[model samples]
Target: MNLAQRINAFQKLGIFFKQFSTAKIEKHSNSEINTLFFDAFKMQIERAQEFNGWFTKENVLKAFESWSEALSVENLIEWTSKYSFSKNTSPKTIAIIMAGNIPLVGFHDFLSVLITGNKALIKQSSNDKHFLPLIAKFLEHTNPYFKNKITFTDTVLTDFDAVIATGSNNTARYFEHYFGKYPSIIRQNRNSVAILTGKETEEELALLGEDIFQYFGLGCRSVSKLFVPKNYNFDMLFKAIYKFNNIINYKKYENNYDYNKAVYIMSLFNILENGFVMLKEDKSYASPIATVFYEFYDDFDNLLNKLNTEKSDIQCVVSNENVVDFVKFGQTQHPKLWNYADNVDTISFLLKL
Candidate 1:
């Protein structure tokens, strides 16, 4: 489609989403137009029925609502407008290795690459193979042209114009070795951390649960650590997040949580912490399994120095105020067409390309 046509289509997509109001959501009890979302709903429901743990209906609804709101035409256009790839500049083939930590985790990449008029060669994570296909099928119903551009595969990849891959630090070595020669965005192990100022309320603490347990702390965007003042009390925070105890298990996630928890507790000689994760004091960003440790600081100057020193390894930090001009976390992953993860400026990379 031409740029004008594409813009119009996106506008309609936004309106169509808005039309699926809360009343309609309750009345229909299923998403009809977006069969993909319905498929996700069914998958989640089946999981809940068969397994001990999964997201509640309320959490799933909130997640769906968040997706709908973020994918609205206004947000989509606003995010992508700055980097509307010119027909001449857009790559013809782009390889994307998606993360399966959260539901629809890599959707932003799929949407961005395709909307920018590039072919997406997606490698789905074994952890999450179902959701992307369902979404793609829904988009196919929305517009048939999407089918030719978005393809999922495990085949050997070569000759892509560009590449984007997210994986653990160990896997990152391999990704950089393989795709480094070309224009690429290789994301290694990155975790989001929260800075507690002791001024937050119970309501905000509950919202922070969204940042931590939304995807069961599986997504890279999930807050796996907290930075607080020295000797900060956990009474309020733990009490607030106690309601999400159900997030610790599902079918597959239970296995992960159990295995990781065992390994950590065994190594550290401790029992499972109250939540799905363990809290300890650490100087690093990543944590083992469901365990997220924290560090206490006495002063803002010390915090600033620590952040500056650790900036190279840090990806996103969720805070009430703008801690840094670049890093952000907590429901702000509505990336533009060109906003590469891990603070990699895509325009500069594209210019090199």
Candidate 2:
């Protein structure tokens, strides 16, 4: 199939999933679509487990479910329209450096490249090889022609029309020095933080756990730190999330939990230690293992000044209102077909390219 055909086919798959999710399909007689996805996902998880103990089936299902919901057909179409990639005069190539923090963490990049009728050179994270290949396999089954477009490799970074790299803040310097010659989106280390005005209800606080504990708090979009008004109680938050004690891997997480706790104790740092989580009074934007750094705010002006200085390391501030220009921390790296990393507007950048 041609590039346009591949893009249209992938778009159709996205649309099918959306319709299936909302029970919007007219003939509910066929439930096979849902089962097919589940079976595919199960196979992917089994394959991924061969790589490491971290890629558990339960987590993989959760991640896929979330992506399926977020990338609805209508939303996908809306995002692609904004990019105008389908209407471009010349086709382009996109190189993606995917992150392995969460299952299918690089889905957005895959979706963008496919829907835009461009070839994608994907460098799969060692942590994410199995799941993506499974997705590619399933897509190929859906349409055999896509087999060539979604090429996966560990090392394929050369002569690309554009580049997108996600890594630690320090790695950004390296990516810029290396891939800077081309139009690139280089993301540095940034942590997501939440703001508490001390008025959150029990339900809201529980939902906040979804932002924190989901994916084992591994993604850049995960809340690594938080800002709160002085004297905010932790009881309400902990009590709300205590139900999820089983979700955590006790042995593995405890090792990290103990290591960081010991380091903090030996260094005499002012840290709060809960059985499952740790809270520290630190100025750093990122937190330690199984922990989140928090700072007390006396005034909003002081908070703003502090935020301005650390804006480069901060990804998003989850608040009731839109506190910063960047998307909420949880929303970073979660572009549809149009949104790009580093908060870059994909349409404008691609059009110029």
Candidate 3:
């Protein structure tokens, strides 16, 4: 299909996703997509946790809500306008190795390949295998050209022109060993962090709670660490984020809380807890579930330099500070279409192939 046709089809697919954006999913005949896929998708969302407990209905819905907003015509047009697509360019099959940490996590790479008029050969993470195939079916219904544009397999990939893979550092080495010779964009583990000036309003800190707790902090975009000024009273942050205490009700998260709390207690690590999430003074950015690491910063400039030095290990930074390309408080999980993961522009990389 041509670029305009592909964009039109995806915009319709976004409209399909909008119906599931909220807990109160509504069905309507605004278009044929609703009647065709609405109930099936609802069933899929309900059963998602059976496959992966982390895919709670609310979290899955949050992902849908984010993608719905991201796929709006304005957003899509603005994202694509910066790229030039040549209709006559020969299509290549781009293999994508998806990460399953959160619902539909690798979809951005899939979208990037397809939007540029290339075919996608996907080897989905077993943890997140259910959603995309169904979505691909919806896209096929949205436009016929997508009928053979997407393929999912469980076998070793040996027939793609290039690769875009996301995985842990261990799996990354494997991907490089196997796909190294080909043009590729291979991603490794990276965590997001929040820089707190200790002067944030309660409303802003409350929003920051979303950054920390969304997707149970499973996605790379989730904030796992905090950079705070020295002598900072975490009470302000705790009180602001208290509303999310309800998250403890989820069994998976609660088990993590209990286990991590025990580990901290036994290790004699000083930690602050307010019944649900725990805060430990840690120098690392990737914190375990139910715990967020906080490091005290003495000099702001020195801290910025430290972050600059470790930029490769960090994803997006959530801060109001004038850090270049920093994400605002709650918006980390809701990245725009152009907010490429690991700051690697997937579109630009795909265009080169």
Candidate 4:
């Protein structure tokens, strides 16, 4: 298919996704395939929750809604506008090793490969095995040309020209060793942080709660750490985030809260809690599931320098007019199509391949 056909298929896929959010699913007259795929995809979404504990229905819908908003015709055209696709160049096979932390986590890479006229050999994480294949089927049905270009492997990946892998710091070393010879984009563990200037409104803090509690804080874009001014009062923070207390009702999250709280208590470490979430003073960027770490900043310039020096360890910085290139309160999860993961331009990388 040509570039216009590819874009149209994805735009339809986005519309298919829009029919599955938490809000009422409205049937659009323009969407013909919805009658064929809607009920089946809904069943898959329900099945996905059973397959992975963290893949709650609400979280899955949230992911779907985000993608629906992102894959507009305008977004697809703008995101691909920077690249030139030569009809003479043969398509290459790109193997994608996806992480299963959040729902449809590796879809951008999958979309990147396909949109750039390359084949995708995806090895999805066992924790998130169900959804992508069904979506791939939808894409194929939307545009038959995608059928030969997309493949999912349960066994070892082979016959690929390049690789895109996302994993922990440890797994990154393994990826580097195994795929070193090939052209690749191998990403390591990275966490997002919020910089609080002690001037945030209660509304902004509540939105920040969404940034923290969404997907149970499993996404790399989730804020795991915070930089606060000295002597910052967390009373407002706790109050604003109280709406998300229902998150603790999940047994898995409750277990984590109890276990982490116990560990802190036994170690006699000073930590704050609001029954659902825990706050501890830690310099580390990566926090445990039920906890978020906070560190005090004395000098703004020094804090900026430190964050710049450690950019590799950070996925996003959440703030309001406090830092350069910062994502606002609740927007870290709703990244635009052009907001590439790891700040690595996936489309640019694919165009080169």
Q: Which ten residues in a row have the lowest lDDT in candidate 1?
A: 48-57
Among the numbered candidates, top lDDT falls to 4
lDDT of all the models against the reference?
A: 0.65, 0.68, 0.90, 0.91
Pairs that collide, model 1: 277-290, 278-291, 280-293
Candidate 3 lDDT tens digits, 1-353: 68888888888878778888665787756467677788889999999999998999888999898898888888889999998886439888999999999999998998999999999999999999998999999998888789888999999887789999999999999999999899999999999999999879999999999999999999899999999997898889999999999999999899999999999999999999999999999998889999999999899899889999999999988998877898898999988999998888888888887
- Tens-place lDDT per residue, model 1, 1-353, is 54445545555454444433323443243356644455454555346323323334444444445566666666666665665355445457889998766555677667656666667899988766655676666666667777787888988886688888888888889999988887788888777788888877887777777777765666676777788987688888888778778766554556766787777667874432675656767777777656677888888778878877776676567777655453333453433434456778644444344
Ranking by TM-score: 3, 4, 2, 1
lDDT of 2: 0.68
lDDT of 2 by residue, 1-353 (tens): 54455555655455444432222222222455545665554455556656755566556656655566565656655665554454555667788888777777777777766665666788978878776776676677778766766777766476579987887767779889989789978777777788877787777776677677766777777787878899999888788767656654556667888898889889988876557788888878778668888888999778878877877776666766556453443344343544445566655655566
Q: TM-score for each prediction?
A: 0.79, 0.84, 0.98, 0.97
Q: What's the residue-level lDDT of 243 in candidate 3?
A: 99
Show where candidate 4 strays beyond 4 Å.
Answer: 26-32
The stretch of ten residues in a row with the least summed lDDT in candidate 4 is 24-33
In model 4, what is the error at residue 53, expressed in angstroms? Answer: 0.7
Residue 107 C-alpha lDDT in model 1:
70
Candidate 3: give the clashing pairs: none
RMSD of 3: 1.1
The backbone clash count of each candidate, in order, is 3, 1, 0, 0
